[model samples]
Target: MTTYTLNVVIDNKQLLLLKENCYTLCIAKKVRDQLGDKYNVVWKGTADFTQNNQFKWAEQYEVFALKSFKIGALVEAASKKEPIGHKQECIFNDSGVMEHAKADPNLGDDTFKVTNQYGATSFGISTILNGEHNTSYISPVIIKGHVVFAPVNDIRVWFALKLPTGTMFSDFTGEYVELQFGGDKTTVTVCYDDLGSWKLKDSNPGVVG
Candidate 1:
């Protein structure tokens, strides 16, 4: 499990991965960076996508506690690269991988770095990610589930799993559903079926609808 503490200083914040190998933590930071501030992460844990969607990347999950961080605490990160130990291995999957990595592929020396915008310059550090699960497409597999009714005027109706990314729904038919990447894992896909207007059983964070 990758562990890190987010330290907020003045207007800037620092992400530090406290572990023997900085690989997982670094990857998590990159993903979080891409996510911006929409999602909150307190402590991220292992993300599991082990079934149905064969690809590990697509099944990947980041275990983390959520937090709606204050924008005022936001700061820029300085970027750079560094190296890790040669003996150290970066495996892509959680399953047995040492044998497959018998010979180092020489991903080469150097990895990325990020520092808090805070005045403290000590935040810069080097980290490495062994093997990364390739995430080209996540299965838009069908979901055999049910929906629920939320109060009117509220965006939430019902929720469903197995929705694809970038799906769109319409009200022209009186009620339509749309599935955006929603978030990191696209937690819930809001849609309607033969039943009355509905949504994913579970709603996306910060999304009332």
Candidate 2:
């Protein structure tokens, strides 16, 4: 079982700490409700290894659930003004596009093939979070490197990403994309735009949607 160390923060300062290693989604939600809308609850933990854990390499993953429109603002501010001159392939499902087309009649046919887009030149917010490197470091210090940002009340937008060649597991039942890196240990980074519309599996705790 995977557990997390939970912390409550307000104004960039930690207000409460729960380091019992027993924090889960249910416990976090209860704490969030009790804290109301003024605080931020964050957790740091490791994900359970897959049944086929053949490779014994260490990996790091981080999830950030920010307040309303915070993710957009951050992305916009961090995005490069000019392209980086190279594109990376990204695999995404057509569900989000189809949903948009359904909402707007002017979008035309909702039935269309989704193709991988290799047009991402800039790292955007990733540069700010991971520093000069575009990916996370391997076997980073837990307290300093691995961190989580839980939602404050109704905030739904989330940012979940992993380092290159690092596997990420999420229970987000929504439209998402993957950026895979193949090597001795294959791994991929999962991306989700909005969690409000996605349905999370209630059976599992700490599962993002």
Candidate 3:
């Protein structure tokens, strides 16, 4: 038998309201009713390793189960750039609706550590409340080293860049391609005076369209 917990966050105010047995989806919807529709609900729980008395905690996993709620109180407060009901929102680059959220200390989930400690990151907010483990080290601490942001897996996405007319190319993502005199697709080297359409480079293996 698997047990579950319902987690909700109202801007910065977080609540793990469900205590009794209930459908996880139903609990998520309830929080959504009171909070609007912007907040995310992250579910955390333990898994049964065996039918015996022993269980597993080492193989723990954090799943993004559901996201259904909004804290109107929090959002309204953030626009003024102030703490809203014990939560603070920090927006970077002076843009992006997505803001980094910090929970109020008074709420008492040990999230207060983030407020006092600078240069350290919060390990896991939900993990702290669940009592699954201790020591809140949110973000990885960097100590004087070359930081590399390498993708764990190959990513496929569209790339659109303006190129100068007659510009020569060398290599990209370990692949190489050269542009021709020009037909339809925009040339790699030269920027066109007129609006040009984009097409896949010929050297791109297995990419046709």
Best by lDDT: 1
What is the Cα-based lDDT of residue 128 in candidate 3? Answer: 24
Q: Write the per-residue lDDT of candidate 1 for residues 1-209, one digit (tens) a residue.
A: 32211211111111121122221110111221221211111111222221111111122221111111222122122222222232222222223111121224432222111212222222211122123411111111111121010101111122222222112222112232332332243334332323434334444432322
Candidate 2 C-alpha error for residue 2, in Å: 19
Candidate 2 global CA lDDT score: 0.19
Candidate 1: misplaced stretches above 4 Å?
Answer: 1-31, 38-191, 195-198, 202-209
Q: For residues 1-209, what per-residue lDDT tens digits would candidate 2 score against the true structure?
A: 11222221111111111112221211111111112322111121122222111111121222111112221122222122221111111122222111111122222221111121222122110111112211111111112211121122121222233211112222232322211122331322222113212232222223333
lDDT of 3 by residue, 22-117 (tens): 212110000111113211222221221111111111112221111111321111111212111222322211231323444444443211222212
Query: Worst 10-residue stretch by lDDT in candidate 3?
Result: 25-34
Worst 10 residues of 1 by lDDT: 146-155
What value does the lDDT take at residue 156 in candidate 2? 21
What TM-score, computed on C-alpha atoms, does each candidate reach? 0.17, 0.15, 0.17
